[model samples]
Target: MGQDVYEELEREIALFLRRARAISKDFARAVHPELEADAYGLLIRIADDGGARGTDLADYYGIGKPTVSRQVRLLEELGLVERRPDPSDARAAFFCLTSEGEQRMERMRTARRERFQQMLREWDSGDAEQLARLLARLNVLFKTPLVDGP
Candidate 1:
């Protein structure tokens, strides 16, 4: 309701993002010693989406096609992902995790979840659910224009 409240929220969100970036790097290394931190998210997206086209990934992340292409190339080289021909489009291909990639990502996700549970062990389950709901709402808000302050 107050300007100070918004300022505090902004500060907390910034801190949370910074911490998340660091944790992402750690997780990426856990998956593969040579893996870059940014590619870790791409792996998760492909695994979750079942598969995705390079252009679709670019659009989802609001990044350049070239950037997504480079990451996909690296994933291919590492044997973490494979590209399959799109049945509908001769010129396009869909990326999906290879069996090796699927296994590694699954293990990493399980560990990450366990780590989160440990970190939140002191909080009640209801509080954790409330935090998840608030975060989901915040993510949805990020896609739309904010209302002007009164």
Candidate 2:
């Protein structure tokens, strides 16, 4: 109702993002000592999608093709991802996680889930579900330009 509420929300979101970034870095390193946090995110996307084209990845991340190229190259070099020629497109390729990559990512994800469960152990399941729903709504709002609130 007041500006204090908005200010507190901003402060809390900032702290959450900062801590999330730090945790992401740790997850990336656990997957591969050479993995960067940004690349680690891409890896998860690729795995979720089963495989992905470079162009698709760039578009998803709102980044340039060259930047995605560099990250994909690094993943390839680290033996975490492999590129296969696209059957429908001669000039395009799809990237998928290697077996080693899958195993490492699974381990990291399991640990992350366990940590979250422990952190929320005292809370009721309904509260956790509500938190997830609210976060998802906030993320959807983030996609559009912000305007002054009434």
Please give the RMSD to the true structure for each candidate, in Å: 3.1, 3.1
Candidate 1 has an lDDT of: 0.91
Tell me the spans in candidate 2 whose CA falls farther than 4 Å from its real position: 145-150
Model 1, 1-150: lDDT tens digits are: 999999999999999999999999999999998888878888889999988899989988768899999999989999999999976796899999999999999999899999999999999999999999999999888766465668
Off by over 4 Å in 1: 144-150
Number of the predicted model whose TM-score against the real structure is largest: 1
State the weakest 10-residue window (summed lDDT) of model 1: 141-150
The 0-to-1 C-alpha lDDT of every candidate, in the order given, reads 0.91, 0.91
List pairs with backbone clashes in candidate 2. Answer: none
Model 2: weakest 10-residue lDDT segment is 141-150
Q: Give the TM-score of candidate 2.
A: 0.90
Q: List clashing residue pairs in candidate 1.
A: none
